[model samples]
Target: MHSLRNTRLPFKVSLSLLSLSLILPIQTSGLLFKPLTLPPSHPLSLQSYQPLTSATTTTTITTNNTTPSPLTLSTNMTLFYPAETAPHKATILGFPSTHAVPRDLLNQTRNEIMDLAVVISEFEPVRVHVRPEDESLARRILNERFQKLEDINNNNNNNNNNRTKKAKAKRFNLLNRRTRDNNSKEDDIPQYHLDRITFHPCPTNHPWVRDTAPVYVLDKSNPAHRIAIDFGFCEWGGKNLREINVRNEPLGLEADGEDERSPVSSRKGYAAPDNRHWENARFAKRVLEREFDLDEQAENNEIKVERVVSPLRLEGGALEVDGEGTFLATESSIICPHRNPSSSLTTREAIESHLRALLGVTKIIWFPGRKGLDITDCHVDGEVKFIEPGLVVQNKPHPKTGKAEMEIYKEIKEILGRETDAQGRKIRVVELEAADPDLVGWGGDYDEGGEEELEKEQEEAAGTYVNFYFVNGGLIVPAFGDQKRDRKAVETLRGLISPERKIRQVYVSALPLMGGVVHCVTQQVI
Candidate 1:
């Protein structure tokens, strides 16, 4: 059983992100929104950065950044949605709990998170929202990771005792971005990078903060200012609300065809009593509304953050913004019956208008994303990512993948070939191949017929490389144990992205099994 110790530390609570399992339903594409004069495009590279002590603390990581040009949009624009590559004050992730990672996979989940947190902290500070009960366990896990690193360093030092000082120093300062820590020896993640990690005691139903957390947008009025859009979540159509080990409630139903399935069937992610993920939704709002109960920073240094409440319900993983004015999303993830489930929000125009009002979105490049595929109904993050406005990367499925999955990627390529972005720039699409499913080995953990739902659902997240997270000066990508493909992924991203930004892969096994990856679990506060 998972520990529920009552020891309470100084609580700092802010939480978000969710992943749901469901089938995919194809929708029509091509809804080009009218153009709007948006904020100028800028490259994200930080000469300097401020540590994130609160959610509202604003920071910029833009190179040769420019102010927003005057806008002629339908809505009076204030909040500017920066691209994922934009400078981030900090990145937030939730520590996996009982139901999210399952009991048997808890150790693997924690280890994966440990690898992610430590490596990410090498680039920027990380905020981990750990439930109060799991605080000590989380700390222990990190400390163990730190000690393991120290041992490895010690071994290296012993082996290369006669190495020259200059060679050692050169080997130590690898990226040349982070200055050496004077206090620590060799500066090799001294103290497991624990100094860069801050823990917040909070409640979380699921740990995919990309879906549950606030989608931050920079304010055009003030570049140092930010707005947190709480695009309310419904547990990915409430399909993933069920805890692990919960059996799929039988409804005397079976699949009719690929395009059709019973909505109430609970076969994908299992059925829970209700979503009950409202705590995470409320957590999103509290960040903007309340005083930082644990904020230690001075008042003058804090960046101003504004909040805009919206009726739209979607996860951060569903929408990909170019940090200009264009938006990309799966149609089923946003406008379907579950997310925008109201008479007023039914139409495409209505949903687009709300997006415009909320984030000043000018053009929406819609893909016929299949609904009920994985926990996200085919979240766009799993398929495509905007390197900037014009340049983007997509996941090309393994050749052995199902016809349904292959067709989806083919459509994405076709759309990119035809469509223009919000700023009238033709999009450039790069294809990144996913790891072969047969080659992805999850070392005999799950019970036979345990969590593997169905053949179609399993193929959705079979080592997808696009679901990666962006830190301040780094990209956190998943490694699916395929050495060749994993190495190829790093090389590809390095060639495509900024030279200063490093591409690091964290070996992920359990989350991908649950239909999520690095991007699903992490959120950036810009």
Candidate 2:
């Protein structure tokens, strides 16, 4: 563990941060967290072993394909961060088994993810990860979905061809008539690119890749170089405890099925049958190693992957970064004692220092995230997202949750309005309205769960459209069943994004039922 070096911050900048340190002060009083005592049985503590092996000890395996072999990093790897709107090499997504998920809503969630993958493929390459047994199921769904889309496109293309032929025959008429373009009308509409999407076998505990998967970054020393940041994840502050406990039972065999488990599940992070939460993190790294290896080999085999390991227990969803230097996060998720105990991070300065070194952030804005409001402890991804360097998009409060839940949004907007970006430009905030109540409870009734589980679904069903991903030339956004609100969201996004970007929307009602939306399941490689 000592072999993995901590990244050093620049001397001049370190002095600057020390002199201009800013704390939450009285503005975030109740949010000030105290250290927590870890349960005796809990595997996580300040000194607990990391979920994955030391970077130096990571195994190197060669695939039969032309791809480069997975490499290891004994020292810290400084990574180059890219803005969310930057061009992406590819996007990674995951799908859970129907057995692991509630059977009643399995089809809904599966179709939503499939639809999301298909739509995103139209813009940039997409990779869908599934458990080994579910690989065929994923392929079948995507194939059938794309085939239908292809048939429609073919029919439309035939009609367009006929129109073009008729116009071509009358050369003088074509000159008199507005010169018709040869391209089909569907050219304006993004057609699904089946070739752009590839399915891979990657067994995961859940489908939320944004949290568990390795965050991609470029090497600062070499722009062509790529790095994978394996920041340790503890299953969203150990919210997976219930799921892990249930899986340890005998009846659990019937619930999730034995086929879903991966060989990586036997690692140190998953040694304890009672808490298999960290298994997701371990398996995610394995999947990313393969992705990085293949992508690098396909581009430049000389460029090797540099792995960076961090001991911090945080989820990618908890913090939002504008590729430049500004970072947005909630105190309850990162600064909270539950995730970053004093024994580990020690002080706010120490925590911020870690973030600055790892994320290359200059300023971190902290908000008092409502504790227990959602599983992620009010992750900023749900409330705030950066469209560009100085432009931000925030979620509107749910109609059912009312104004009380909206106070946070108002506070954040007010503060951001006064703040400036790395280039010293005042932030421009855009508000994305909430989903209608009628669409909130669309899929909750199908699941026969306990009152507590049902209540959680009700609270999360109407997730805002703010949680969206920015691809190369397009925006992948969530579309709730509410016809009016969905269209409004697309219109609002068009106003916020540049006119050149293609906006693609998918019906993602099932995501809210599981406590996340579009952005939660996708992570882009820069």
Candidate 3:
């Protein structure tokens, strides 16, 4: 049984990048936003990086050798949602089990998460947070993985050991780029030692860590210093309030809060059952700050947390940034009245200012993303991603999803094509067809209620290959079992990434059903 040690740590507390099993659909994307000006673009490099040397603190890097930029604020904090290829200290993951989910669904979800974690660990470290009660389960799963890997490596243990040593030597030389050669035979699978993963006790609401966890930034002045930015989460602006309220009720029906607080008929609008969800974000910030040793620099005058207490509620997925100056976002998800009601960002200028301050992007490209197209109101990550600086890749619209998405895609392509990046370079956009529904595979059949209902669920399950996540020298992509398309997606993505990077495809058929992909569930610590 999962631990019930703290009421604050309930099943609903766990969040993923995609959706949870909760009825109201806690699946969504965004980041906490405020206004700031776009600073000039400058080249930044990880000159002093030393990976895997310290478990508690990440290696510091510098932008240049002399007259470093002043944006580092004594806090040494610069929010760079740069290309995923940028070096990462670790990746964060959350595990949750809920009574609301069937056993088969829960098991499948956990296994998939484990698969993702294992693959990510191959490139960089992975820090997993689980309820105290589930620690044993997590360990058992990881142990089995370790054993399986050991058996494989054992076949040629001596030769593999020599190769591992050589790889480590090569890794040190590429510290500035945080890259490594992709020529190793054990490139696809991680080592058996399991030295890269650290399990911690943290409570979360669902597993959408990317959306719910605090965003990390490095100090502009001192790239070594890190800060945790806690963007507030309210279950997609109380869209999940009804489910939270219902779960809180003893009878699981009828209104529990005052009418004024009700999302259905409230002057204040829908308030979550409690701020327990916020705890996960807060917990992540605290834990990460400590792990990264951001606090010990007490003399440096770093704020423990940078809270973007803005009316604009956002998930990290809503914004795509190229650390240099270019930023991409959708208007419907961030600016629409549904998500930003009563926010101070009433105009395009206001929105731009907020994004600049919060995300540090100067040039903003906005797409008229369709509202209600997905629960997230259309996060940009699902449709577009920055492969590297000045280069963006977008998914071609699927005929099955309809005209609204196609219209949005066309507008995005046109705008991006005309616009220039913050660095004053014409944006380069690449097009790749989104994974079709037929290519996507599900773990098990849905309840035999009716074909119409099942069809609706399957339609929603159509996730795209664009939702892949980047690691040190690898790209972890979602494989929907459509053999042909899956292989093609892999090849296409491989062509876009640096030669040093390889592809790791994990079967995540369930992620699409929840309105997310691999990037949704994982939040990289840069």
RMSD of 1: 14.4
Candidate 1 Cα misplacement greater than 4 A, ranges: 1-77, 149-192, 241-277, 286-303, 441-461
lDDT per prediction? Answer: 0.58, 0.57, 0.54
Model 3 stretches astray by more than 4 angstroms: 1-81, 99-104, 145-189, 241-311, 443-458
Ranking by lDDT: 1, 2, 3
Model 2 local distance difference test score: 0.57
Per-residue lDDT of model 2, residues 1-526, tens digit only:
0000011100111101001000111121222111122332222222233233445432211111121222222134444567778778888888766424555456656766777787788788888888788889899988866664454445444565554433222211101111112321245645668888888876564677888777777756667766666665544544432222223432222224222232121112222222232246465455655653456355533335544545455777876888888888877678754543324353566577667766767878887876645566678888888988888988877556555457777878878878887777888888888776555435221223221222223233545788888888888777655656667777777777776777766655455666677888888876
Better of 1 and 2 by TM-score: 2
Model 3: worst 10 consecutive residues (lDDT sum): 1-10
Per-model TM values vs. the true structure: 0.70, 0.72, 0.70
Clashes of 2: 1
Q: Model 2 residue 154 lDDT?
A: 55
Give the best candidate by TM-score. 2
Badly placed stretches (over 4 Å) of model 2 are 1-78, 149-186, 243-278, 296-303, 402-404, 441-460
lDDT of 1 by residue, 397-487 (tens): 8787777678888998999899999999999988889876654434221213223322222333357788888887777777765656777
